[model samples]
Target: MKTSISKAVAPVAFVLALAFTLLLHGAVPFWGTPTLGQAVWTTGFSHSFVNHGLLPYAYDFGAPAPASIAFGLAGAYPAALLIALGMHPADAYAAMVALWLTVAFVSAWWLGIRAGAGSVKSTLAALAWVTMPVIWAHSGYSMLSTGIALLPFYSLAACMLFLDDVQGSRKIGRALLYLSSCLISVFMDGYSFMMFAMGSSIVAAYSFVMNHSTRRRLLTYSLPVHIAGFSLAYVLFALYIGKPSFGAAPLDFFRGWGADVTFFLFPTQGIHWMWDTLGLSVPRSHRELFGDSSVWKTTYLAPLLIAGLLGWLFTFSKSRIASAALIIAVAGLYLSLGPSLKFNSLVPQEIIETGVNMQHMPAELAIAPTGSALLSEHLPGFKNMRASYRWVALAAFGLWFLLLLWLSKAETLGARSAAAILCLAVIGSNLPHPQRYLEIPASNRAQFKAIDTMLVDDMREALQPGEQIAFLPYRNDFLVNYLAPSVPIRTYNIGGDKNLAMARENWPKTMRQFKMNKVDPAFADRLLWLLAQGEADAVVLPYIDMLWAAHAWPGGKIHQKQVQPAIDRLSATGLVDIDTREYYAVVRLNATARVLGQTALQAKLRQTLCLPGFCVRQAASSNAIHSRVGRLSANTLKSDGRRGFLVFGPYEPVESGTYLLVVWGRAPVPAGAWVDIVSSRGSTVHAKFSVPRTASRPDNILLEEKVVFDEAVDDLEVRIFAEEGSRIAITGYELRLARSGPDKD
Candidate 1:
């Protein structure tokens, strides 16, 4: 191939990739775009940026912080720019996906040619990479898909920066490229960037020990870029998002969602056309045989790539990059296995015995704890990175990179023919059915109906600048968040943060209390306090959102059942103006209500206290704890004929004085129950109340005691102890200051 022709192929190839992207999605109609699920959040964020210039410092489910800490902006910026230039938000999002995907193709093509593969082979390989089933699997998730597209560019920059052969101005250019790539990685998807950093470290370490020239380049261009890139990331995150850490994922979650050995070699059930057309039931059946459906199967390397990698293993030499790729690939696979060693979705532990002749059985094999599980439990970064199977992203890249390097060496006819066969097989195996593309719903249909019908000017007039609106059924808010930008309203809810608690999971109990007929005054008071604490100026019940969510989300039925009652109770408050619409309702909190809520909340906080169930601690694995008003729903704790402490709290008193403590609850089993005022540090119980069973309401007071503290006590705690066979139901506790003066002897 001619040099100029080869140089021109990348852009020409991008056009082709863009066309394929559009065609695969059946072309975007003007009324709606090709996006759904998580894509809605990115699109909504773009709308916000376009209309209000709002940058979210706190994400959904995350505490208020800097916008730079999250992943949406990378995809959001371009979409916002397009929206600013007059494209519809939906169209902008579709175009964004096309643009990033084309970049991925071009970047990989460029990298392959630079690595010495011929233009024809490189083009084919790059196209194959773009067309992989895994890429399409994340089509709706803009962040990860964009990050995936950017990976090849980051790798290319790394190659250019560290190569001893490239010197002078080229080295400087590479350094600049490396810095930009690093910054992009930070803003794009932190997880993918972390994986790249880890993979690069392995390569650099290997290269440093093996070659003198490589070591020199590492010290020069590489060191400076690392310092500049990392320092910049640290400073930005420190100032805005606080410390940079991945979301804390639980150990069990990591194990459950981990990658299986078989997935790496076989295609996932639904993605490939062959599984259905060829009547191949084994692929679906086998996956279901070993583990639950939770185990991610999106990391499949197609048959062609797997074959090429297996072949490379036998013929590979001591070349630094090639050897490093192997090591990185292996490490990625191991880490992706999570805390347990799963082979073909089954654990290996015991050997099967047949009449004294022992035989190993794959089904019986089990490994409870893997190194990754231990690391996730204790190690900072490891513990935070709960989705261990995402490590397979690095492995896939390494294998592709290695395959490109291997293809560059193919000169003979026999070698070329073998390469052709593999390439053909890859294209055939990975080709998505056109019907699959047709299944994607139009984006306009998914949007909140209120956006089109509601008068933006009228809504804006109703709300003040900087006033925050709290949306009921918080999870459904993202779908309607597109309205926020046009109305230019500030909201308490954040979009695009999956780690946040699902409103459906946490709101049923609270909604029950909000009912007009069966309203709990104390609980209502607490909720009003929570709203005041959240600085919510208004509450919006998106009736249309509930309708949309009912068909699309898990908790629609509950939201529908409970929302009208909530509206009735809010109207009953008589503290605000209610704008009831056909599709939605907005209950604005007036100035008087805000003041009263704050005052009442302060009074309640001073004396009354409620303890959360021990089960609530399970949320620690998620990033929701960072939020002040994070969801910790009301729950009941039950003991099965065992004497134990049902609830323990390190609750401190507002002031040191004599107080009347009353535990409001009931013991259905008529067993003995007691309350203890204990020191948080030492195992010392300062006060106790052992009361006999009595005929009372289910949620009535169980025990009461007058406790006195002479001085300020910082480490005061309450422990609720129950006797064996006791079925205790504890609602809350009241600690009223009995006297203002100090205790007199």
Candidate 2:
């Protein structure tokens, strides 16, 4: 009963702490974006995991599939739960926050147990681990949130080491278990692996000193197998992290996290006092952290007192102290440079005139060192360790362990009271932070003015179930944000930042150079290919329109040629076509859209809708539509409650420049529509359809088809009529134009 009760204590505390974490992120509309001390790593991890099988869209570019099935599955946990229970993304994300906390709890408890810490000690250690100021920082700071997950696994590995040591087992079973953990750490992150190396170094060094006589025996036999297995695993997992460049290191390593460790416990600059007290802040510097929280600031609680008191009062051997210090040093350095003050972001990435002058280093730190090779040996599916921030977690865990050790010797109430006083003194003296205070609960975070309404209904309406898309409302796009918790609903897309990095023959061409390939190597060919393959689906193309400005294209096209090799393979299957961007949505026909649509177009549209197709407008009415999507005519049953003009087309594919679409119903560039022409070679040209500014104009909306064509083409594939199947009614028609030639520059 006592053991059970002890076990329950940490878990219960962890649950409460996690609940607090979720509530801080907001409950319903989970649109948390981490700011200064912004968690880029966390963002990447979450996105790569959540949007698992979707095409890459406007934002979520450069994301990779979860290399490992084990812990990499963390990203999908929240989405799966919410889905299982029929919950919304926001609720699912909130639940994820809770789930994340729970994972932290379990991991911490397991770590303590592994180390042979008694049940009570393990529980306290776990509680202390979750409540660390850094963990609190991540909670209040959404950007850093995903990175916290690494902490638990890290703790687990450390504890495993402790247990293995205690058992003094050089047996094969124990050795294999240790090796398994080494493999598991790789899936965690690149930094997690580094920390594991660091921590293991400390342990191994200590082991060497303590067991000097038996050291050779341990190192020669079991240790060799362990080391060999580890070496082989690394080569397999970290394939992408090829040839390291000792360039600049990562800034988050030191700056962003400084405030998390030493001072500014809740230095939420500029936020009110209430939230500050609860550990959430609305600092101007980290707006991404607390901007949406109108009611309650993202709240967090720092365990400064607990950690500090334990550090000062509890006595441990020199080795334990060193372990704690290393963790603090590494995590503290990263914090100091990141959230605390400033971070270096610029790197000269200019490609050389001859060969590439690749300055591939991240904004702050150098990529991991090289000598290592084998991915299968180190991390089969993923790198077990990375996310340097997790070291802070290990630091917290180490501190708690020492405290528990100290607590064990206490004989009376006086001794306990003495220890508590020491702890209180440390807590009181060491903690120096300004808190954020807000009147509302953090649950009611602000979206846009109508964002709450949109999330409740509009977002759902916007997305079709099983149709993949990214939902972003952050500095970066949603693919990089919401996808982490929403993983498995979709997959990573090479559409955004990565699109440029990608090419079509793009698959083989783009992937040929990488150390290890994406899970589905031929997975390249852009989000377009994946969509075509049914391996990928839709993209929630974020139409950058936050200011209520017109939603227009933020120009940048996908390079299908990069993944040509992958495309070639897919094409062989005949599920995909070899030529013409029309078969793939990215380079296919463009659609002229509005907020609403007209009666004639609506009739034509209903008939033309295929199992799935694209829209290409040949012409439109001259009247200026307000750019909405609904039935424009009064008699039609279709109506968008919010009236405006109209927009149409999830268009049908055109034969690129080969198809000459002569618009007769609407004049050249009709007022109600945008005449967007995409060439066979994948170039786009646009002309708006609007009312003529000419004086002698008679009709309110005259129909004119302005003829525009490529001077280079000898014969264009002509669409005989405006509708896909109907004959022409004949009025004045406008010829939609495309640019003259290949320079597409």
Q: Which candidate is the best by lDDT?
A: 1
Local error of candidate 2 at residue 462 (angstroms): 8.1
Candidate lDDT scores, in order, read 0.58, 0.36
Per-prediction RMSD in angstroms? 8.6, 17.1
- Give me the overall lDDT of model 1: 0.58
Q: Candidate 1 regions off by >4 Å? A: 1-14, 22-34, 51-69, 223-235, 281-295, 310-320, 346-380, 438-466, 473-477, 480-483, 496-523, 528-534, 542-557, 564-585, 588-745
TM values, all candidates = 0.73, 0.46
Predicted candidate 2 versus true structure: per-residue lDDT over 420-532, tens digit per residue: 45434333322223321121222123322123343313434433444443221112232233332333333333322222233112232222222222223313223332333
The number of residue pairs in model 1 that clash at the backbone is: 8
